[model samples]
Target chain A: MKVKKFLIGLADVFRFIKRFFKEVFYPPFEIKETLRQCFLLGNRSLFLILFTSFLAGIVFTKQSRPSLASFGAESWLPSLVSQAVVRSLGPLITGLICAGKLGSNIGAELASMQVSEQIDAMEVSGTRPYAYLVVSRVLATTLMLPLLVVFADIVALLGSYLMVNGINGTSFTLYFNEVSAVVTYLDIFSSLIKSAFFGFAIGIVGSYAGYHSEKGTTGVGKAANTAVVVSMIFIFVIDLASLQIINLFRVQ
Target chain B: MRTETDIIMPAPSQPRGNAVVEVRHVSKSFGDREVLVDFNLDLFERENLVILGKSGTGKSVAIKIMVGLLKPDSGTVNVLGYDVPTLSTKELNALRLQVGFSFQGSALYDSMTVRENLEFPLKRNLGIYNRSELDEKVMSALKDVGLESASNLSPAELSGGMKKRIGIARTLILNPKIMLYDEPTAGLDPVTSSEINELILSVRDKYNTSSIIITHDISCARETSDRIVGLFDGRNKVEGTFDELKKQNNEELKPFFNY
Candidate 1:
């Protein structure tokens, strides 16, 4: 019975995704609302992403310094830090942070609207709530997450540079030059692509949870919790899948 | 005692006109719970019809079905020449524009101010973008509801009565031909409830809207309804004016009128 319920839920989510794709391309597009959502999702999440990414960059570099110094290869610090920050840590941290922040936000907002009958009001008012609420929000998150990840990468690289310059007095130009030379176009492209998927996953998961939330206040709380948990799980799954696909291309 | 098969038709003495909305043999069930069985209704043009039933008696469900919000398991609902159940998305939306639903909770958008709430249906449904035109209609609707000064206030800032008024104002701004009020007086004190009853009457007089008010509030039904239909066990048990129903004193309806 539990398995049956799970399968039913999975099918419903697939249906929801299919509906989103269909409605998203329809005319009377909610361009204004979508842009507003993008601004809200990006602006609200910027501080948290920057703070955590900077700290991660510094901590990872600090931890790696001793091991590289023992090998008399501490000069390779900039290259190693840049590769790690750009190819993995930057996108991953941003994805997880947004999954927690934006995911819960979308879920709770829509769930509250659902419970309060605001969604119904929108419908009876001759407005398509799905197009206005779900599509716009999902589009905003999908479009903004990649941009946020790029900012995270830049800030993380800067944090790495600060740590390197404090210890070795390396010029800013030299450090950046070394970092750029070692980080390939493919690495940056793959990070961005991964972040985009992460964003799409977070947006869709959060929207589905909230749009189909059960009645009452408890439903709102449950929707928010489901969105965060499900989004985080999806992020890790997407990250793992992205790694395998990137590896396949490298091998080819 | 009224049996399940007992269906009371409207009195012949009461004049009836064209039914702008009609429901026939509508049966709806959620899982094992049967909410409506062979339910039938007719709402004439410009008539104030009240469907009076206690909580959980499918009063709201019947209206929802009429609006195409909830499709019944079986039956036909025709509102304004459109078959509600079979209408396409575009057609359903078109039909919805002519029908304004004021929810029991007032369902005002918390994120928007009262003016914005009123302006939403106009902007989205009617595509009215001209600034002066939007402002004129919004203020007019607010004036009708006697809340012209409260336009700048968010729903969270308003009292329960104020929120209900704003909800009605938002609906009225669209100039819907049919108004469906789901428990307009559900959670208000007696004074507020009576005020809402008066608003219903005034809205009808001014807008000439055909309304179906779903309420268990006896006073609300008495004050606003031109005709009252008693709903018991998901079917219409009695139909008449307030005084007629009180005079009939049908066993099933005695509890409703005794109060």
Candidate 2:
């Protein structure tokens, strides 16, 4: 069973790669349709990501202040907030948000299409259904996620800014300087890379489960649920592996 | 109803036809159970043949093998003269150019408009036609299936029959030389079934493309097929004009024809 599962995954990866290339050049580009999907899958979900980021930012800053103060490091508030937003929270929270929304939605949509025989129809029409359905959505997810992460990070910082000054008034310039001092290029790059992988994972897994879905309505729900859970697990696993690799380069 | 003689011997292969597709002693098994055992078929040019079988009789498997979607364990499938098992991905794709499939369910892309679905083949296979030409082709294909007014609609909005028609339209736009219909009207209402049957006949009459239809619906078989090939177990049970099968007073054949 394990061997069979592995082979299936390998075949699906190869199929998906082939599909992506085939679809990239299939004309009547459907730019308007793709943009509509981005709006539905990306933009519409921004409020949830933004709102969660804000609360997370506020909580992290407030919670860390007392601990830092214990070490006579209360002035590290801006630095701590900035590091949290850039290196960890931004991608993590945004990915979780997408895993819940877009992942489930994509899985359900594809599952229904499979159940309805739409995929087969495309195959018969001399169209590569994999290219038409999976590749476009995966590409959209890949391109839209980094931008969403950027938005989330910005909102998170804004929330942190409010929380930091709420308890003790601090000048905006001082806060800004302290935050910028701690946020290295590595922090930004690592988080961005992680989010892109997260996007890819979400799109591929969701489409796979949905595309191969059977058993009708129950199957649709199962695909959506599996996509969210599996992608979330992948996100955390990838994040941890990345952290260890990044740490390996420097002796802390 | 059309009698058995008219349905049994559909134009008898096709004038040497140069063997467009050949299923040579092909067999398939899933796990321990065998689905098809030593099945052989020859598909020639410009003929419409119907494969009839009960559910689970490997009708779909035969189509998959011919199309190179599934490889047979022990035989050769040659499509347009290219050896299927040995063909490169690019080569298989080239062969696919000559074949069109309408899956058991109408498989229109749920996310795309009917116009987009129809245009995809023209764009993919033909490449780079002007927008007006593409639009004209899409409209003509839709009109071929009596779905011209549904250009902007998505599959979700269309009924089961309409979706199937749109699917046929999409297949037509490709202008494939051979068409495969997998249970084309399995779940449709009776009225819709007749309409689809008419559509299938019209395709053969209008396009002159050789068609292989896999179906369990006897009505569809009786209506559109030039020759009905009965598939039982795995091998062909008996094949002749539909009228022959309908007239066979043999007790075994009686159950199949409900005599």
TM-score of each: 0.96, 0.88
Off by over 4 Å in 2: A1-40, A70-72, A124-132, A212-215, A249-252, B1-19
Per-candidate TM-score, chain A: 0.98, 0.90
True-vs-predicted CA distance for residue B196, candidate 1, Å = 0.7
Error of 2 at B71 (Å): 1.4
Could you give candidate 1's per-residue lDDT for residues A1-252 as a string of tens digits? 999999999999999999999999998999999999999999999999999999888899999999999999999999999999988999999999999999999999999999999999998888999999999999999999999999999998888889999999999999999998999988999999999899999999999999989999999999999999999999999999999999888787
Distance (Å) between predicted and true CA of B38, model 1?
1.2
Fnat by candidate, in order: 0.78, 0.54
Best by DockQ: 1
Model 2 TM-score, all chains together: 0.88
Q: Is the docking of candidate 2 incorrect, acceptable, medium or high quality?
A: medium
Candidate 1's DockQ is 0.86
Model 1 chain B worst lDDT window (10 residues): B2-11
Which lDDT values do the candidates have, in the order given?
A: 0.92, 0.81
